[model samples]
Target: MRWAPRGCGGTRPSPEHVKRNGWHDQNILVVSPDDQRLTWPERELVRQLGEKLYGTRNISEDRNG
Candidate 1:
């Protein structure tokens, strides 16, 4: 699926608003039916977005290596 802003030619999901507030439920990456994994880069991206969405920011990183 493609996620581009209305007038941005359906580019990748890299909107300032999205980058700052993280991706919407529809945009969050899904690893499995029950597990969700966000990379370090993605984590930071979403953290900023969550802050804007909820007015506060809180993210718990689950490292598995």
Candidate 2:
């Protein structure tokens, strides 16, 4: 499956936002993984992607690492 923002003409995800937020921004398409508009699977995918990209860092881990 392929994903792209409307009118993006095949644009890619925003790396800056992803790095800054410690989460994948999906090219600014996904405002949040918890967005109710997204299907459960989509939300789950976003969460997993975020974890994979940023690592599953907890509050303590963030503070220390």
Candidate 3:
């Protein structure tokens, strides 16, 4: 399935935000069954949208990597 943001192309998730939050190279634990079902691109879109709307560190990253 192709996922696109309404009125425009979807945004891309940036590792920069994670790095800025000092979470780069850290393990992020995402616990969403539905989200997990999405393809890699879709998951990325979700992450990107979340970061864009809510700023960095919106999603928690697991530090045990």
Candidate 4:
């Protein structure tokens, strides 16, 4: 239940992201970013946040679960 903005690759970014990601994370419960089981919202938010943070829209749930 965390958000790292893709390339940021950190545990938890901000409290807001934590809250948002956490909400979705529970559904996904990714042991790592490489696991795949994220919800649609989780995936969308991650991708959006990733692009915002990394200046690229490459956030992928393909790796995260």
Candidate 5:
């Protein structure tokens, strides 16, 4: 399951939903500026890391699988 840090202010998929889909990893994606108010360089780093781990697809794309 993917989750950004707190204060991101979005409706996250419920843990039960993720569990029903068999995704149990606590995969935290640093995709929000609210996470430490990341600087440009930090954001870039997070973006690269996220791409490496989760790929560049839209999150919805993964839902079908």
Candidate 6:
């Protein structure tokens, strides 16, 4: 599956974010920002990165995204 943030209008993660998050572009990692497996800083960074790449979620688009 393609890698995209869950609530960020399906924008793909940046290469920098991928490496920082220890992910490869072809890897599929679906985790919530609140996932217990992630540290607080990491979760926060995920949110920040999602926002940086996609601004914010569009409720309308989310129905299909």
- Best candidate according to lDDT: 6
lDDT of 2 by residue, 3-27 (tens): 6667867646686455555544433
What C-alpha lDDT, on a 0 to 100 scale, does residue 23 get in candidate 2? 43
Q: How far in Å is the alpha carbon of 38 misplaced in model 6?
A: 0.6
Worst window of 10 by summed lDDT in candidate 5 = 26-35
> Clash pairs of candidate 1?
20-48, 20-49, 21-49, 22-49
Write candidate 5's Cα lDDT for 1-65 as tens digits: 48767798677887657654553456533254225667888877877777787788465565546
lDDT of 1 at 30: 25
**Model 4 worst lDDT window (10 residues):** 27-36
**Worst 10-residue stretch by lDDT in candidate 2?**
22-31
Clashes of each: 4, 0, 2, 6, 0, 0
Of 3 and 6, which scores higher on TM-score?
A: 6
- Please give, for residues 1-65, the per-residue lDDT of candidate 1 as tens digits: 46766787844655545644545645653221122465666666666666666666333566453
lDDT of 4 by residue, 20-57 (tens): 68668675322322325777667777766656666764
lDDT agreement of model 1 with the native: 0.52
Q: Estimate every model's Cα lDDT from 0 to 1.
A: 0.52, 0.67, 0.59, 0.58, 0.63, 0.69
**Model 2 alpha-carbon miss at residue 33, Å:** 1.2
Which pairs in model 6 have colliding backbones?
Answer: none
Per-candidate TM-scores read: 0.30, 0.41, 0.36, 0.33, 0.36, 0.41
Ranking by TM-score: 2, 6, 5, 3, 4, 1
Ranking of all predicted structures according to lDDT, beginning with the best and ending with the worst: 6, 2, 5, 3, 4, 1
* Residue 64 error, candidate 6, Å: 15
Give the clashing pairs for model 4: 33-63, 33-64, 34-63, 35-63, 35-64, 35-65
